[model samples]
Target: MKTGLREKLKWLRKPDSTPATADNTRATEPDRPGWFIPQKAESLLATPLRRQLMKIIWQRTSVSAALFAELYQTPVARFAVLAQQLPASEYHHHAYPGGLLDHTLEVMAFAAKLRQRHLLPAGAAPEDQAREAEAWTAGILYAALLHDAGKLAIDMEVTTGENQLWYPWQGAPAGPYRLKYRKGREYALHPVAGCLLATRILPDSALNWLAQYPELMASFLYCISGQYERAGVPGEVVQEADRASVAQYMGASAGSVLDNPQPSLAKQILTALRELMHTRYRLNNPQSGSDGWLTADALWLVSKATADNVRAWLLQQGVTSVPDSNIRLFDEMQSLGLIIPTTEGKAIWTCDIQATGGWSPGRPLTLLRVSPERIWPDADGRPPVFDGRVSPLSSVPEQPQACGDAPAMSPVDPGTGTGGDLLSELTLSLFSGTDDHTAPQASMTPPSGSEEKHIAGDGLLTVVPAETESQPPPVTEVNPPVPASITPPVAACSGQNFTDWLREGLLTRKILINDRLARVHMVEGMLFLVSPEIFKLYVQSTTGSTGDEWMLAQKAFQKLGLHHRGVNNINIHTCQIRGPRRNSRVKGYLLTSPEQIFGESIPEDNPYLSVLEEGSGTAT
Candidate 1:
């Protein structure tokens, strides 16, 4: 099958007439009409790197150039015309001229590689798989190519000749165009917008062919629409491939890109919170407008106030990526395990505060519950625990899930014995999205085998729910303060030191394991460290260095020969996260010897995580 395509396309292979150089020169030449030299799509894509990428893409198809051209090249050309010199992001990945095109092409190539490993129509018979293989491949390619095409529509204001407004839906510009990123643009809006512009980039023939396969078409649509959670395997393949491309450009690897860490954002947030708590925030005050109340078990911060202040603080500190919306900020905090969740797995809690001084809020206040230890790792630094009780009000009424079109299974609230409802109708009117806000929460019921368990070994906290109502629930430390004695006093940062620090942190409960936001996971009787993240955390903690320095630590760790390299000598390994609803993948480095970190007492393998065999077709 491959030979036939190669033979037919042999004549198409030819040397480039002009020497290849970076196309970014054209992007920055001039925004003026006189200097804006419009070029043909084919000519624009004639650069050596783009030509080579196209060749790789065609090779992955294993089809004749004529057939592949009609299927892929045509659409790519159309995309080039529209994307000409546009960047992928303002200040992030591929933020150069023609970066968007390069990133898209790279993603397509990477997706092609990943597609070979999966037999599409998932559980279909071999005959069916063979029959639908090409369609599935095309679907994956189309999904990857058009993944970020919506950026043209939503992120930028485009003007053609004579300052004429240009819309992507109106087709490629016939004359010179000027483009500028929109200020205060929603970072996530482009994904959905991409769906609308798909028809403009993709030919009807290709779309019709893709539409023939219902399952593939659905996934393709979902992916382009940015509903990855619903897109199934196809979405995952596109996401991973996209990550690989981004990682390559960002000077990281696929493994680290698997779960791209916001290197300084998390640290910045924590720092801001610490500063706010220390200076501006009024805690445990009986006054009605006090910033928060710190009880024995949890620190309850007023939701809106804290989010607003944190965002303002970060913005003032020159962190522009902080979410403008309070809901998104809350979600970010919860995802980072900075806040303790309610029984319904939500970040914001509706509680009534009754202070010992006979001062009480007349109405229920929306608050974020944070574990005390996360704020004050040293017990001596904490303020005296509050003497009053903070009881949750009755469960709020469930609202429609705004994030998705359909309603998912509502998790029952442990406090009310019913599904927790929408925050909008209650105090969180501004927050309108799915109620699945995950964070750490102490369960009232006994732990189930299926539930995530925290074991105290190597400094991990073994949190046992308090037996009495009077006693406070023990909090598990997420980011504990590193101790001086744990280090060997080498003073130099090295791989051994990183590992030693990790081991000591786990043992001392300075670093959390098996938590929602944890970077380390026990899988297949070995330790899986989420790359770049764990390394970034170590770098940030030890040297307080940022930006690409973690790569040094990663290289140092690789030299120790502690990690098992995967196919193509990939340092990152894939782990399947088996959840109650669906299964997902996590990429990291698996330790060659778990004993090196844990010694004789190895913790139980994370029940939710199972390492996937490299290049394996199956999840297990």
Candidate 2:
């Protein structure tokens, strides 16, 4: 190991010298100025819920778990001290007091449970599994436990009793620490923070054991660094556990994993809506309320407008598991408190709104009415109501045809039914990113951590509920840039995202690029990506997005005028297929440059493919 890694290993072992019990370590606790999690690390872990988590951890990795205690359980205790009292998220499941501890225990237990089914270091011989199982299990548990630790300091502000600022990377807070989610903290990379945090909590001995398994250690690091795609089975285990935990907590599943393939569908609906509200839709606008309108008494939003926007946004962000129906979308929103129940307890309402200025005639529209205070700001200007008396146009639907569980295209409300069932899941503005205090605004550049799958189990409050992931907490400043250089921005939908995606995919093994005559290749240090398939992928990612549809993306790449043509001026190439039956030609393009997208070495050329470049006849 290099000197720097050696120094880091030495530092990770530093906590082991102290007693694992908080009481024993209390006197020696570093005198720092931030509020601690408000409970001793040992005590918190000793709780019934956490004890059960330890039980699972022990069963999964008894040898390593024993070592955990032998090391004074000091590192584990340090994490608990920093994580106590803080909620895993501002809202959604487990967003209340002590949510972090609950969530941590849940994820650890879930990861262990999921691990029981996998033969990890997958494809390894049975003997190798027996030898490495405990170590692998321990690494996963540790990874799951610390996956979101970055949220501690990177996403939120931890303040001292005297209100002094404290960062978790500096080490565990000295005493009871208060958490204030930083405003506009959407840009911080909590996963990167988790990697930094692991330095403080992972003991050197544990590191040594884990590092011995190169594949296991690499996956472990990939997971901690927020690149789940590379983490493989271990990452999948963590993800599955996260999803299951979120489903269990948010009442999506009553602990029945087998109930639905999409156990977290309800959570997904809410999350999609939340993301739309955060980055795309406008609420409480005065002149033009394209998405919704909020007034002092209530928040009135166009039903289809909100639904379409939420669905489109979620799709663009790569959440493909969302339900396809607007009715289903409304049902989940109504179930999750994104919309209030009607007098008869349905999600949709029909009413006529006349312009307050009397410049326009009365118009009928389907709308979702919610509590005004839920999204309105007391300090800012309010929306003006229409002049006409807003009355329910019709009675609620009676499970008719045409729309599935949705009211007919028109509105209907029967005064007969009572307020049926109020939503149990009321999301505070935590996951949505902005509340009333932040006025509706236009789109800004995507945040720095766009590549990361947010999932806040609660994404912008949109994506996964079973994961109970929270949005990255607010950051006080721009985080130091990563050592890896980012690809410069290119024209939207110009196959630019595909290039970057392919590069990362190659590095992370998300895309297959090393096989013979692979669909994608690097030649002359430039990309030679397959046609149509690459275009299809880009299309799928931006399902509901406008402007950059499939054909448009293909055209955009063509317009870039970077793809190569052969000496015969052929952009498409035909290669001989060495088969008994026949030969074929596959169409692809040679993108301009590799350094343009990856900004790093390709590491190695694919030994199987011929290198192709523009204005060159060489096939080597």
Q: All predictions: root-mean-square deviation over Cα?
A: 21.3, 15.6
**Backbone clash tally (model 1):** 7
The numbered model that scores best in lDDT is 1
TM-score to true structure, per model: 0.45, 0.52
Clashes of each: 7, 27
lDDT of 2 at 105: 68
lDDT, residue 175, candidate 2? 56
- Residue-wise C-alpha lDDT for candidate 2, range 1-620, written one tens digit per residue: 32332343344443444333343224333355333445577667765445545655565554454454743255667788777667776534455556676677667766766677688778899978977777788778888878888888676777766667877665555555667666557644886678887767776667776888899999999999888878988887776566545544543432232111222444455555444444445543333334555554676667655555555544433344444455666676665566786777777776655445443223555678866544432324234543333455665543212233432221111111212121111111111222111111111112234221121111121222232222222212111111112211233355565555556555433344533324565545557666545554444433332222544566556655566555655554422222346533334566656666556545355443455333453454
For candidate 2, give the lDDT of residue 67. 57
After TM-score superposition, the amount by which residue 582's alpha carbon in candidate 2 deviates from its true location, in angstroms, is 48
| Candidate 1 lDDT over residue span 579-610, tens digit each | 68987676668886898998886878888888
C-alpha positional error of residue 518 in candidate 1 after TM-score superposition, expressed in Å: 14
